[model samples]
Target: MIQALVIDDQEINCILVKGLLENFFPDRIRPYATSNLAEALELITTLQPELLFLDISMPEMDGFELLQHVRKQQKAEVIFVTAHDAFALDAFDHQAIGYITKPIVSEKFVRTVSRAIELIHQKTNTGLVETLKKAIITSGNNQDKRITLTSQKGLTFVDPAHILYCESSGNYTTFFLVNREQIVVSKQIGSFVSKLESHSIIRVHDRYLVNLQHVTSYIRGNGGLLVLINGKEVPVSVRRKNDLLHFFDE
Candidate 1:
């Protein structure tokens, strides 16, 4: 079963969305609706739902503000349901799993929810199993592992300690290890980043991603740059330098 929460100020919108999800997903969907952000936060802290459908415009605390709070505590995938199209880009910038515009279309809503459920399974089941397997292979012992990666070739088990950095290459991503080897993955860096974002990986540039554990120094070049433990330098766009620096400071 997939646990879900719906946060909207309007009762009708909440009921409509809940009914739609129930019709499609049946007993698999656990829907909780609330008009208050504080109550939603409380539910999140306790229930730790796998999915959250949020409305951006609200009375006291809006969806964006609620999202910030949710990201701090839980790994729930967020799907923003908003009336305005202008906030779509901003929602994605915050790493929202999906964005749905209202008045909600039944087909689109179902499709978005399905995607969210798939992502939940991928992250919790497949991703975690790979993480554990990596620990056993690397340590030659049975212990919990922290990170894992999959590619076109095969699963490349890794210790977070051995990772120097990661870089995005269009639709593909490359991971540089401390042992002077690289892991090329078919998935986009954004996908990898989403999985590892809660860990040490940080986005230094639009195309360049780095694991903070392997970041040796920050250099101010023509544009800013991140010097990794492997002695490789990755250019950071001027626009993202401040955000990177702020992330490090935290």
Candidate 2:
């Protein structure tokens, strides 16, 4: 049986999806539903379901925030369920395999769920399994401090060590990693600097947040640039040059 968990602020939405699972996949899926985020989180921790149907907009905790916690603890494949498609881009950025728009279409839900099942069987989800594993430790007094980044499909949990650099434009930030690949999220560079300050990540320019661990060589001059181990050149702002030097020297 496929363990499935459905979370939505609306009780009706939860009921509707659960009903669909029962009627269509009665033998295949064993589903559980909750309209409360707190209760949902607890169930997720205890049940450790293989599939998640999460709503984006909620009262106190949105799906994105809850996902940080979910991705931290479990290896469930997520499918975002929402009333509108406004956050579709953000959903995809987070690595969600499917996006089910509300007033739920039977065909789309079934198709997406089928795809989720197909992907769940693939080689333990490859890089994502290890990525999430290192990024989120759900043990006693969790030790590793990892950053949860928004991806093209869902929220991506990243170990600070895996990051190469971040380039931002307008309201979006694109993360370039050393191992997996590049993921573009909707947040700007300013939002990430605070989260990464303790780590080796530093904002060298308005457009860049480069991981100091990945800096292979620093080419100096007026507004000098850095060469990352991944072969990418990131520019260092004139104003932040002194700060970078202090950080390195320290």
Winning model by TM-score: 1
**Residue 133, candidate 2: C-alpha displacement in angstroms:** 22
TM-score of 2: 0.50
- Model 2: residues >4 Å from true position, as ranges? 124-250
Q: All predictions: root-mean-square deviation over Cα?
A: 12.0, 11.6
Single out the weakest 10-residue window by summed lDDT for candidate 2: 121-130
Clashing pairs in 1: none
Per-residue lDDT for 162-201 in model 1, tens only?
Answer: 7777777787788888888888875687776676666677
Find the 10 residues in a row with the least total lDDT in model 1. Answer: 142-151
Candidate 2, 239: how far from true, in Å? 58
Per-residue CA lDDT of model 2 for 1-250, tens digit only, reads: 7899999999999999999999989877899999987799889989999999999999889988888889888778899999989999998888788999988899989999987876664434445656665655655334446666655476566788888899998988998888858898766789999888677888999999999988988899777999999778888999999898888789
Positional deviation of residue 22's Cα in model 1 after best superposition, in angstroms: 1.1
Candidate 1 stretches greater than 4 Å from native = 131-250
